[model samples]
Target: MRNVILCVMGVALLSGCSWAKNVQSSKNRVYFENLYFPARLSTNSDDKQSFTVSVDRIDQGLAPAREAGRYEATKYCVATYGNSDVAWVAGPDAPDSELRIVEGRLQFEGRCDV
Candidate 1:
């Protein structure tokens, strides 16, 4: 009986997290809603301050991938920058082409007037 209860409880708990996964913004107010990363930025960085900004600002980098990537584009936010590969633009003129997450960086699609 105990084992059965544990299994039911486990399943319930797992599903609960999926429903509320993307509840808060990232360090830069970038709004990480429904984005999945092998290692979350919160655990992969050294600076504690950078962890607070939710807005993802790729101020300096090698170069944004002009070409699309491999991963399914995550449709959310102003823009996303991760492993730093592709940058999908989510603006009024957003194109019909689907973006790929080359490394882990993402570009939110379907813009709304801010």
Candidate 2:
């Protein structure tokens, strides 16, 4: 019985590793300047048309962070609204002084236009 239990534990550990790999690969990620920036897009539960894109690791490069945020916002708009039209409230094209960064993450806000 102990040998059987050990075998089952081995199988479970191997499967867990593969499952983690699959989950990591399934994430929609963007590469910038040969590096991957972790960008995420989130929408307000009360207002689905408005969204925010946040890119982490801004210390690496501002240009890459901006591109990552823009890419994520575009992807979110396209996926949620079936179009890539976004009216930027605070976007990548804005001047450097206007960009929003908080806690090492750059954020962009926009509304998806139908």
In candidate 2, position 104 carries an lDDT of 81
Candidate 2: lDDT of 9?
100
Off by over 4 Å in 1: 25-114
**Cα lDDT computed for each candidate against the true fold:** 0.32, 0.90
Model 2 agreement with the true structure over 15-112: per-residue lDDT tens digits:
99999999899675568997788998889899999989988989999998899898888888898889998899999999989999999899999999
Candidate 2 lDDT score relative to the true structure: 0.90
Per lDDT, the best of the predicted structures is: 2
TM-score of each: 0.23, 0.79
Top-TM-score candidate index: 2
State how far residue 33 of model 1 sits from its true place (Å).
20
Compute the lDDT for candidate 1: 0.32
